[model samples]
Target: MNATATFDPFSPDAGTHQGGALDGHALVQGDYGTAVLGYDLASQVLRDKRFQNSALRLMEEFGITAGPVHDFRARSIIMLEGDPHLRLRVPLARFMSPVTVRNTRDVLRRIVESINADLDDSAPVDFYRGVAQRIPSLVYCHLAGAPASDAPQVQSLSERTLSLLTRDRSLTPVIVEAYDELFAYLAGLIARKRAEGLGDDMLSYLISLGDEGKLTEQEVLTEATSMLEASSVNTAHQVGLVVWTLLRDREAWQRIVADPELIPAAVVESLRLFPRTGVVSKIAVEDVELEGTVIPKGSDVHVAVWSANRDPGRFERPEEFDLDRERNQPLTFSTGSHNCLGQGLAKAEMEEVVRHLAEHYPDARVVEDATRIGQAGGRWLVDRLTVHMKP
Candidate 1:
């Protein structure tokens, strides 16, 4: 199977799946013989109860299974499902309550300004370094109530953990060490939050839950570790890519600057084109049929959300980066059992960041080629982006 592995994208070559013509990649439209492509609308059915999610299947695809082995060290709601997943989500949802999110806007605004204060105006400073990465980190750190000193450490851990994602899991010890440091740091924070009680901070929110017994001390540490990566790393790579895409496409750049309203659409379109979040692995339980293909019981199923978003049948000119094109919503936040819980907060972050860029730095343009970081899930960026604007 390793010999037959190939990457699929919903672009011009996408005629294979949705354009009514199978080309390149030997993609069999409806053939179900061990093919990785979505022959049966995998996403639609995975959440359906007819199928089961088994742990053995997960072990094949992802080393980490969702079950709690020895307490909840890395166990997060993202890994859980059904009743267990729902139980955790219910309490966690309170942290992201709309009232709470609304209150964070001013903080977000200030964060963007503080990070972007000194642009590399000489030529093009690396946007990733200057603002894209910093804003999200600062915003999340503030929300979590992490101390000033821990912000940089949290950022480093996010970067290192993401780096391990793309690897073949060969560097286990290094990855283990990276996580050890991160979890240890979070564990300490949890202790602090427990003593301090609920306050006007993200730590306080978690502490409130602990007091209510909604979250255990162990769960608190696990969630803190999960929260930082989910909040910062993806946003950093995403914003960097979106900015790069717009800068290259003159017309798209103009559209954003002129209307500013289209930024949200652009954000969605960008996610489909250059997904920076994840290429998740889902475990399958019972045997499933799709387009004449039967995935045997206990199999590791990989659904390419990014690839699905690019399907020509669902999207016209699927690969051309057309924000105005009529298409179904991309799975950036996903749907059903494991949708992103922080989606509401993430959207607000993207909207605020983009709005600020257009309104504040209308003249910003790319000065050099953007270099993207290649990690497990494809979310890393380093580039020199020169923006021309008033300081």
Candidate 2:
């Protein structure tokens, strides 16, 4: 059945009215083209090899430039497939190894401490700008071996690129400019690292790999920029949303504060309720049958993570934010080959920040009603989360 309907996937009510797996999936006429929206179907599409991350190509097809923005994406691991995908991902796996995680924990803890120390206690603080926005950039930049001085500039460029990437619109000159600036920055960063000799950090690791001929200079830049983008972009918004979810819910906050061990579970539940990266798209390489519907070859299918995470069939009382939910699996990170490579780092950032707040500000609560902002790209972001806490 082909039903052409316009949908505001980015709307504040995007997932609230959705219930059950059956209701989660639908074919809607989107601004770019047709899109598939549903939990079970979206999960399947993500895991299916036939459904691929070809959005860059699709954008080009729709008259977007194949310039620096496209070049970076094409070279980045995100767009690679099959052997090339594995080849790019293999060495990078070292960055997320058990040893790396253990090493980064202290850095993350310190970042939380620093951010927390700068905030005023009694007045309502804009957590989104003051705290959440700073964590990802600082943590990821520290891990990437980039100089602290470079973060503000890199961060500004990265945010613009991310916004352009996720939103649905014609590519504007501004985004293209961001890509040019970012490419130059990453390239220059690599050159400096090579001149100074390599260190053990991710940037230096990639440089070493390039010297050994495992990756080309362009590929190295792609990898470094990919890490910068992954580590700095979505995670900040996720951190904010998760914190909002817990603090707004008194019971959930208390549970986490009482048992610090429950912090991880709270993070998971927050992801389920309000996934920050709400939608991911894939192109069907061949005709695919999903939930009694046939998605034709070349079709652009949008996997709505926001709807998927809240499917009633997948979770009991899907709307309720229950930290103790027994089966709390979420597709916020996507799945299959293209699943998020920075999941571990992102999780660590979320857990550490939430744990710090729970311990230090037990009585903390959102001072004003939070506003939900929707992006044209189907992202549900928390606009301003003002929280009242004791010093």
Candidate 3:
């Protein structure tokens, strides 16, 4: 809108642009097409169906022009719109609903405690590997009714498949192979569920839906695959990010320790500051205009979630952690019809992890010298996070 602000959001130093306006414009154009940099504009673009997810195109860019992987991406829930999208999204939403997440709290707490039990708090530890990276897959196993023994493979597959989001063309082969293994793994799990008879888990529910004609066999597999790919990796990093953020801010950590009821808000504030998926790329299906800029059809429109979350126009002290901040809705999980269906479960999982740390390791502090947290390709990644649980 203002001189077509120019900067690459994917650059390693992209994080340098975390203010209300990028070059005094909420929407700017560059070689990467348009970037929505303000909260209001980002919200509008995310909800507008005319702007579709660019994941399918991204796959093609990586040379996955045709095949099962491409076909699946083409039909995945993120790429769908209207009635077709609802049909796929509704089934998964039922499992991640507020009631279901509330019911899963006890189980989440148990899983967190079990994972922490093996950690020796006598010395500083790599919290990222020891705790953050491990919880989500176990949670997935619980939801899908798979054996807990399958958690490691589930975590690995999710990580490799979603690595495509890193926009690394070099990971094309790894992405394809990961999806193939994912499909096979889901098929085997589905078959095993059938042999054991249907259970109450999400996968069993999908299988029953297929048997009842509510979904086709392939549709069932697609739904399961969608759940599996999205189940682990992001949440794991986010868990580490939240812990890293909370522990580093002694005031906030102390507040959370004093009142465990503040854990949820504390987690939200941390999410705002260091969202894992900082960029949500979309494509214009038809000509679209925003803030005086016309995005031609088929053009890329990257929503800079990291920038929007810290927009001084929307946040009082955009860079500071404020647990009492009202209506603190960050696009970390996104917003709109296509917003994360697993967000409730993910938040519950994070909250429980923080709660466990607060109650058991109140004196915990981040060992910053042994930690590495940075941004790349517009995503916040945790390379290492060391914490002295008893210090």
Candidate 4:
């Protein structure tokens, strides 16, 4: 085995290694455990079923050793593999597939316009809270057949439930309470859908499957809970990050504003640059050999997706935002069977937001002094993104 390089993937400075020699070293050792740094290696690890999502272990580490929260994480689609994973993943996948997302474009556009209509474009606005954070939950409500009035609570629940990624032990109570609320909310929503007659929505679709014996009652609830928890928080910050990245790049912004068709590539480039989920933590289920290194069973392996996205070995001029880059596939949404099921929908959401801005606020610019973006626990986040929409 080659001498393993050492670095802290969670450190604030970790992003500085992007496009550096770290990309040459496929594997690196850290206090957290092994980190797959190279683009190829990261791809391999993400696709290898020998490694499983560490979310359940993470919850246990956060002191959620048992309960509905722990039990849910243990059986969630992310933790399951093989046939079991497919059983839960396929239904959700059908809803978020490219075809479905394309059909939903009009709805997405309307939602973006509706939200932008409320923005005070005359001054620098808190774009993160005002626009980005608001869109996903609204989109969720539309998909789940819930009232738009439930958006705020849905947003709050998603954020708090996924706070486990922050690795903050202090949030144990908060995380627990959030999951409890999430379960109750999902139960009520599922019951309401049944009582009022099923409609043409994702939640209703899941219920229909349950009626046909395709999924158990518990499985139906689990699927709904999984979709709800994973839906909002990440996509919200990513929309902010993509907008913040694009608006700041004068050259790119000018091109996007001139040719609206480039909005998708522009959004993708931004996703490559500032992926919200920067690190995907997995646990080795069995001894695995990679590049001659043996990752023993039960070992933690973190894929530094931010590093892989900017790997000089994989992307030409990897640090630059090149709208013309061919095969601009990044590890932001992950890969393989366990990859993000909502990615197509997430990308569509981002593209619509960008299209709205380009069409209505071509002169928009990010207010850097009032905006705050940073990374922690290997994840990039938008704390505050202030934008002068009409400036």
TM-score on alpha carbons, each prediction? 0.81, 0.92, 0.98, 0.98
**Residue clash pairs of candidate 1:** 52-285, 124-386, 165-376, 166-376, 373-380
Model 2 C-alpha lDDT per residue in residues 280-389, reported as the tens digit of each score = 87788899876566778988777778877877767888888887799688999998888887887888889998888888889888865554544445676667778887
Q: Compared with the true structure, what per-residue lDDT tens digits does model 3 show for residues 1-391?
A: 3527577778898887765577678887778888888998899999999999999999999999999999999999999999999999998888678998888898898998998889998999999999989999999999899999999999999999999988889999999999999999999999999998999889999999999999999899999999999999999999999999999899989889999999989999999999999999999999988887788999999999998999988999999999999989998888999999999899998999999999999999999899999998888999999999998
Q: Sum up the clashes in candidate 3.
A: 0
Top candidate by lDDT: 3
Prediction 2 global C-alpha lDDT: 0.76
lDDT (Cα atoms) of all candidates against the true structure: 0.61, 0.76, 0.92, 0.91
Output the worst ten-in-a-row residue range by lDDT, candidate 1: 25-34
Candidate 3 ranges beyond 4 A from true positions: 1-3
Rank candidates, lDDT, best first: 3, 4, 2, 1
Query: lDDT by residue for model 4 over 113-232, one digit each (tens)?
Result: 898788778889999999999999999999999999999999999999999999999999999999999999999998988899999899999999999999999999999999999989
RMSD (Å) of each candidate, 1 decimal: 4.8, 2.4, 1.0, 1.1
How are the candidates ranked when ordered by TM-score, highest leading?
3, 4, 2, 1
| Model 4 global lDDT (CA atoms, 0 to 1) | 0.91
Residue 26 lDDT, candidate 2, scale 0-100: 56
TM-score of 2: 0.92
